[model samples]
Target: GAGVSQSPRYKVAKRGQDVALRCDPISGHVSLFWYQQALGQGPEFLTYFQNEAQLDKSGLPSDRFFAERPEGSVSTLKIQRTQQEDSAVYLCASSKTTGPGYTFGSGTRLTVV
Candidate 1:
């Protein structure tokens, strides 16, 4: 992909179902980040990756939240035991080694019902 790409732009999950969101970054991009944006609030960083190594995940709210970028170009965010409070727009971004700005993908709107 020439830019960051996310799939299933909208998702609706039953209360206990788990969901996996995918992100494909631009070719050669070295940095990737995941964020969760709640309604009426700014995006909150969830995790960051430099190439295939996950550098930070301190912002992940709970053990059920997980993110990974393996082989360096693509990533996935998985949430277990979906809950209403977890509903938010999950955003994925990529940059060139800490570039001042990132190219963000159209977020995946997750709705837990």
Candidate 2:
């Protein structure tokens, strides 16, 4: 893909349910990041992966939030036991390296009821 692609543009999950959001970044991008965006605020970093190694997951709000990039290209952000507070837009971004700006995906909006 020419740009970052995220699946299931929107998702509605019942409370306690689980959801997985997928992101396919540009070819050869070595750095991938996941962020959470509330209704009106800027996106907050959740996790980052360099190649297949998860370098930082400190921003993830809880243990229920997990992110992975198994092959260093496509990534998935999974939320376990969804909660109402988890309703937000999950954004995925990728860059060639740490020195350059990233290309962001359209995002997957998750609503927990």
Candidate 3:
């Protein structure tokens, strides 16, 4: 992919249901990141991966949230027991390195009801 790609641009989940969001990063990109954005807030880092290795996951709100990049190219973010607070736009971004030059996906909007 020329840039990051996320599937199911919009989602509506019943409270307590589980949901999975996918992200496909650009070819050969070494860094992948997941972020969460509320209606009026900036994106907050959820996790980060460098290749097949997960380098950071401190931002995940709870054990219900998980992310993986097994092959280092495609990634998934899963949220278990969705709650109303989970309603937000989940964003994925990729870059060749750590600091800049990132290409961000349009984001997956999840609305828990």
* TM-score of candidate 3 relative to the true fold: 0.97
The backbone clash count of each candidate, in order, is 0, 0, 0
| Stretch of 10 with least lDDT, candidate 3 | 94-103
Residue pairs clashing in model 3 are: none
Identify the superior model by lDDT, candidate 2 or candidate 3.
3
Candidate 3 lDDT by residue in tens digits, 52-96: 899899999999999999988999999999999999999999998
Task: Give the whole-model CA lDDT for all candidates, comma-separated.
Answer: 0.94, 0.94, 0.95
| lDDT winner | 3
lDDT of 2 by residue, 1-113 (tens): 89999999999999999999999999999999999999999999999999999999999999999888888889999999999999999999999988549999999999999
Model 1, span 46-86: residue lDDT tens: 99999999999999999999998889989999999999999
Model 3 spans with C-alpha error above 4 angstroms? none
The TM-score, computed over Cα atoms with residue i paired to residue i, of candidate 1 is 0.96
> What TM-score, computed on C-alpha atoms, does each candidate reach?
0.96, 0.97, 0.97
Model 1 poorest 10 in a row by lDDT? 95-104
lDDT order of candidates, top first:
3, 2, 1
**lDDT score for candidate 1 against the true structure:** 0.94
Clashing pairs in 1: none
